[model samples]
Target chain A: MDKQHYVLQAKGVDISVNSAQGRLPLVHDLHLDLKPGKVLGLVGESGSGKTITCMALLQLLNPKTIQIGGSIQLNGRELNGLKPKEMRNVLGKEIGYIMQNPMNAFTPVYTIGSQFVETIRAHTPLTKKQAIELAVSSMAAMDLQEPEKLMRMYPFQLSGGMLQRVMIAISMCLRPSVLIADEPTTALDVTSQMQVLSELDRLRKECGTSILLISHDLGVISALADDVAVMQKGRIVEKAEAFQLFDQPQHPYTKKLLQARPMLPMEYEREKLVI
Target chain B: MNLLEVVGVTHTYGSFRSFRRKEKAATALSDISLSIGEGMCLGLLGTSGAGKSTLGKVILGVEKPTKGTVLFQGQDLYTMGAAARKHFRRDLQVVFQDSFSSVNPRMTAEKIISEPLENYERLSPSELKRNVAQLLEVVGLHADDMTKYPMQFSGGQLQRINIARAIALKPKMIVLDEPVSSLDMVTQTHILTLLNELKAEYGLSYLFITHDIRAAYSVSDALAVMDKGRVVEMVQDKDEIFSSQQPVVKKLVSSILPEHPRNRTLLNGDVFV
Candidate 1:
């Protein structure tokens, strides 16, 4: 495929952290591509460098301690080595980020409305009234109940599911070209997970927003991902379409991961009666 | 014999009065009742804030119930004398969801596992060390790992340490409150399998509390579904749970996404709940 066709492209991306001993490598040479309106699921265990890759993409990692080497392009424009001020404008406008824990994502002292309106106004030229209107609509689009009441309440007042929805609302309001969700549903229950997934599904379908979904749960990944990439210890071991990857995992690590999933007790095991 | 029985238990929070006015008390659990037979695993399934953990606390005697009776081995737990309660303390133990916070960060694995032994039994240093090593092996960890602190180990390994501490006294019953929820998929299966083996080997009874349907069903011989602090449904036979009539039960069962994309249930927004 031509380079211009991809929405986001990372070529030979490398990440390392500096320590007293020496520079320690965290992620080896990596390559990833996110096309327009495609959901690329990145699956890995904890400490597999999935989050680090996402951070590196947006230049969220501190440059002083962590060195990220590679060429990252968003919409045919180079993103690596961009100045702090330039990167600030690109973040949440060109690329959206949703973290695993929604509770810690917001400032506790500020009301949800204040935070949402502030973030929206920062990227776009709009009045407070206009920003509020956009925030309410975006929140409603995410299917959040009582957007006005939720806006008035503090972050601690909402449930985890509601908070996550609000987070998605804030991230998707600008309609960024790429959305990087790092374990978005890991902290939520099953019902809440389905809600978040459906909202994501709607966003990709209606708006054609490409998503870089990072999660450890295969179930969540399989449900939405058009393509899947299996990462192990900072390297991509396998990349295939969702069905092909889940059905016939090529890498041994991917096979072990699929095998390790908790399944319901077999039919025979459920036959025995307990006292 | 029933290892534990909770009858008409109702737990309320913030019932005490403030300086000027009485606080509005919240009923976390109301008239909740269940029984765990000896050597059987009873899974308590619920979403968050459903009063599942509160019930676990009430059964473990961590909190006093507003109105109820907790019978352990035919003795009323709350009404028992101090001497008897202290004696029974060693027989009942607990493992929490966050293994990191459940243990002291400053202590090594050896000290954490040997805490219950130190409290209940009089043992020399060598004997206590031997018992700690044995417990570590039972949980599928090396004896050398006992010297490491909680931070040095992975999340799954630290949870194993928590399990070792719970089973240290060879407790008759364990209240496992979301023990594997924080870990990843692979580690979850490993921990659940380990819990099952330990249960069969020790003939231990478990009050397995969690929001995860697959984890709960894997080890639970019987399952109870809770919604808003009440036991909405109970599956006496674990197999029949797949076809339960309750909306709450069906919702949980559908939450476990199919392994293959061809069986995807979340194609639209309405199928989930």
Candidate 2:
């Protein structure tokens, strides 16, 4: 792939939080690239700064206590230093974000339809009717039954799976060039998780959207990510094509991670049956 | 005889919109029957809303099923008198999903582990301290850690402490509800290995409940797949779990992403659109 095909690029990206004593480095000199229409998996344990690194791309961190450094480019345009208003425009238009918890993503008081309208109107010149139409269509595409009825329901009324699908529909309705999903399926069940993964895969093929998927589950990463980056203690320990990283992991942490996962039944049987 | 037997358990949660309104009941578990043999781990696998946790609660005596009985050594758990109930509680202990919330933050590790011992037995201060230290050591934590609060430890360490507390009373059975789900893979493996060791040492049975098939396979001697408030399939042989023809079971088995690249079939599975 050509270098220019990279939809999103980050070089030496660092994040630090102000502590009582002084500034403490949270993420150190992290580099990442997302090719167009491909998924890049950022895998790590808790407190490994995988979430912070992805948050840095969208300027989501609080500027008062958090400091971000280095270059972040989306489509060869500098994003790290963009003005707040300019960044706002870039947020839902050029790049969209799906948060870890669908419950926290929306206001419980508002109907799903209302939130969809507000989000759509904020990013585009669409009227309420048009935005609702777009949302219903998007929900339909996700195989959600009775989109009209679902739009009238509150966030609390929906299950985790339903809310997650709604979140995905709302995020992708605008067809942003890139989508950043932070543990998108962590709160969901296995069946719903598979559905969400398929939805993401479909979005990539249908819309050619680049994805930056952050997850602790290696299984999840394996299913969706075209490329993988293994992170440990705020540092990128290894980065490689997904297949290569899984097959012949170079780093000790990567190897340990692979070994730590419980073997599936088929894989377990292969060992026992062969012997 | 089975160490623990859940016979035709049915649990329903009731919701009343107003004082005048009639209660609307939602069935959480429907006629779920299973058993755990002595020194064996029974894995109850299910997705969310599948009643696995409800079944766990019923077996632990935290929730009383509207129908049926949970028998411990052939005695009905719900019908036990006060004195017998206390003994039963000591015999059956539980470890929840979130270690941080499960443990009291204000108490030190020493107090947490010794709380159960203090409830049933009379121990001198020195004896109590020694027991706490021994429990900590068994869970692979340092004896010095007995003085530290839960906040001072990592998630994995906290989980180990939780295990220490669970094993402190030398319970006959432990109901571990998604015990390793919140922790990382390394921590999960460590905890699973520790549980296996403790089971061997104490001959303890476990009701291991989780949504992850891989975790279940790692620790369980037998596997039971629950779906929509029902136990759809039970496999005494772990190897036969993959060959399960139940649609829900097949979906779950196929849902597991192939760890090795060479064995990839997740992308080709037709379960997902």
Candidate 3:
């Protein structure tokens, strides 16, 4: 069991961001862990600070207006005080992040291969040709159709689902100890969302990557998470096993989320109006 | 005649090159025929790019259908002249999806709601104040909130204001396009309940368009499932909708509307358009 120790752990972690408007503690006393080969879902609405907590895990909190306190351990190494360059070395190889908007992450002007190869070179000391080969094979491993063709194509040429799969493929190829995905499927259509989610699930099974999934969509969480944390207004209101949280949530916010959630087939619609 | 009838409507996108040469054109909505009754809500359910928004725009007279006619109260919508169309606008209103942008940032809530009333005719100074207050109250806002700006309110509150503006005109029918899609799920439930209550009070007919089938099921009395610009299946009752004969409609219905978690994802049953 000791071999299955946490790949990522945050204890009493607090994050605050400063804006011209004001400085605010976006996450308060947040404690979570990502054990190897498991998925932990951080569920909440907008402003609930689920994403902030994830950002704090990677020590990626904004430098201005953002204050991060507490311990963030990645593969038993403290990453809280590391410089940005050192952080980057730890980030992709130790902890991979799949951003919510795959569209904005890529440089629109460059080919997908250029950006991907650049990423590979940044971490691995590979020749230019080797980096391109790695990029092509990694993209192919992502289930992308014709990696060579995609290597020449721009980000806009690929659909959101394709881009997301590529992102996952790149992240997994690095074999990061921990993977954090922020609303990974939030921007896609249901079919596309399912496709990306299934890919993420596939990656977990194949690579045994510990995942921290952050989302406002409960259905997505329900489909992916083994552990669940329900957050509200920058606080974790509840934490439980996924099925337990779904079946018997303790937090008022969690119950409210459940009440507000529209079930499939919508049994409630059959009943008369009730507030 | 149906309270609202759409017969053989078709809309296409893209144009020909060389000013007359035909290029690739995609049919947005095609050969759509449907009838909605008074005081009833019907939802337009579809995935993205299913031409649900286009159908709503066509019904609202914002976009002219390439073919077919929309009969409102047994009268053709496009038959009227421009000035006549302006008059018809008073009876047909829209509550768009993005409530934040739908409202004018420069105007306060009162001005936003009363803009239509102010446009139709010049109300007396005191009467305008009273009318705006009444509109706000009808949509569950306080009388004091008449002075607040749109930014001051939450998304759910803003959506309420959108509804109030639509109902302020007392239009017989409303075209709602993904009204609560941007809002959180719980807020969506409240807004939907409020819409139902308002419909009952005003006897409004709604053409509800949304990608969320569960939302459509909750609020709409009947539903039409669209795929690639065609209404493949429609049912008068929500229960009957799930039992559709068409595989495209059934696949869509089952995939999105299920409450249970299956070992496998919802399948298309080897048939889909």
Candidate 4:
């Protein structure tokens, strides 16, 4: 592999959470590298600090609550010591993040059309008309049958799956080099989950956008990732190529996680008696 | 006689600001009837508003049906007076989705488990402690956990504590409303195994309510598929589940992404619902 292909690198990253809840390190000594135009899936249970690593990458972590010490480099640009202005300018243009809940990221007062326009115009000098056109076109590529219909609709009107599609569209409209999606389909139904994830896969394959996919669900990670990282107690327990990790898990934590999958469901009987 | 019976049961949340005026009383549960025998497990599968929950609430006498009856061991559950109904509740219980939320945050695990024994029957403080410890052990939780709060336990561990509390009174049956849906897959398996073991030991019945058809398959001796306010299908044979030729059952069966190796989507779009 060429050195030029490695897009992002992290070394000994640590994140601490401090609130009324008290102070604790959420991510400890985490390290990973992402190649350009490749999908890196991070799998972990709740409170495993996958989201903290993503936040730390863009310097978007809470300053009041979190203390961070580490190094993060994207395309040879050191992210750790960047000034506020430089970090702000680098974030959206270089790294587009799709949060767990897309509704939280969007405003309720405006139509998705207006929101998409604002997102595009904020990053680029494109006018509202041009942004809307680009947004609709990008949304179309995600197999959103009527991007026009979605463009005019409020976030509340669209289903969880459809909103995810729109978010993907907005994320891609700027042509950001790296995209981070955190549990994008956990809120969706099975069919909708497959749909949005497939679309995300298609986007990465076609557009060459390096993806950092973070989810607790191994099934979702297995479907999309070229590389896999398993986290436990704020640490990466295992990291390998997706096939290698799934096929031959080196860590005991990974084995425990695999056994935890719903291979045997006996509750169907309970449903009948209880209801 | 069945342990629980429903005859043409209909539940209506009698109208709203505009809803009542626009439509006749919305029948949340329509002409629903099912019999669950002693120690029999019945699965009710449906979406969020599929009247599955309404059936559970009615069975527990939390909600009264607009039509028909819910019979507990051939006695009408709704017709009883308040005091009698309160007394009747000793034989019934509910385990909701969230274990931590189901448990009072302030109460220790010991307090949580002991309340049922005291409420249902008179017990000395020492006897209550003994019973609580036994209940905790039965549910596979250690006696040492009695001193801990619900927040200290993981989701799976919290669920074990909830189960301990539910079984404290040794109710004839429990209405489990998506108990394991909020839990991880591994935790779900452990809980399922525990429930099965307890049912056999206590000769208990379970009314298991969930939307996931695959999850339902494991614990069900018999199952009912509910759609919109009605049970569209019920599995009679214990051996064959998902082997049904019925179109609606097939759709429900296929929608579940099981470990079985097969392309489930025989026909798309309409089958997903």
Global lDDT of model 2? 0.89
lDDT per residue for candidate 4 within A1-275, as digits (tens), equals 76566788888888887878788778899897888778898988777888888988889866766888888888877898678788877777888888888778789989999988888888899877888889889888889888889888999988777888888888887888899898887666555676777677777767888999998777677667778899998999999887677557899998887666654333345434545
DockQ of model 1, rounded to 2 decimals = 0.59
Off by over 4 Å in 4: A17-24, A90-92, A101-114, A133-159, A264-275, B12-14, B17-20, B24-27, B237-239, B245-273
Off by over 4 Å in 3: A1-4, A19-23, A264-275, B16-22, B257-273
Between candidates 3 and 4, the one scoring higher on TM-score is 3
Sorting all predicted structures by TM-score, with the top scorer first, yields 1, 2, 3, 4
Report the C-alpha lDDT of model 3 over A1-275, residue by residue, as the tens digit: 46239888887888877777787667889888788888898888876787777777777866665789888888788888788888888878878899988899788999988888888888998999998888888888777899999989999988887898888877877788788999998666666677777777777777888889998777777777878888998888899987678667798889888777665444455322322
- Model 1 agreement with the true structure over B1-273: per-residue lDDT tens digits: 588989999989989887989588998999998899999999999888899999998898879899999999988888899999987899999999999999999999999999999999999999999999999999999999989999999999999999999999999999999999899888998999999999999999999999988889888999998988899988778888888899988888877766666567767643222
- Per DockQ, the best of the predicted structures is 1
Instruction: Give TM-scores for every candidate, taking all chains together and pairing residue i with residue i.
Output: 0.96, 0.95, 0.89, 0.83
Deviation in Å, model 3, residue A84 alpha carbon:
1.2
TM-score of chain B in each prediction: 0.95, 0.95, 0.90, 0.90
> DockQ, per-model, please?
0.59, 0.57, 0.31, 0.20
Candidate 2 lDDT by residue in tens digits, A131-244 = 889999999998899999999999999989889999989988999999999999887777788888888988988899999999988888888888999999999999999888
The sequence of per-residue lDDT tens digits that candidate 4 reaches over residues B1-273 is 899998889888865557446755777899999989989888887655678889999898989888899988888998977887776697788888878778899999999888877777788888888888888889888888889998898998898888887888778888888877766555677888898899899988899998766466667778887777988877765445567676656655555542211122222222113
Clash pairs detected, candidate 3: A17-A65, A18-A65, A264-B257, A265-B257
Sort candidate 3 into its docking category: acceptable
Please provide, for model 1 over A1-275, each residue's C-alpha lDDT reduced to its tens digit, 9 standing for 90 to 100.
Answer: 88898999999999999999899999988899998988999999998999999999999999999999989999989999999999999999989999999999999999999999999999999999999999998998899887888889999999999999999999999999999999999999888888889889899888999999999888889888888999999999999988789767899999999888776654234323321
Among all candidates shown, the one with the greatest lDDT:
1
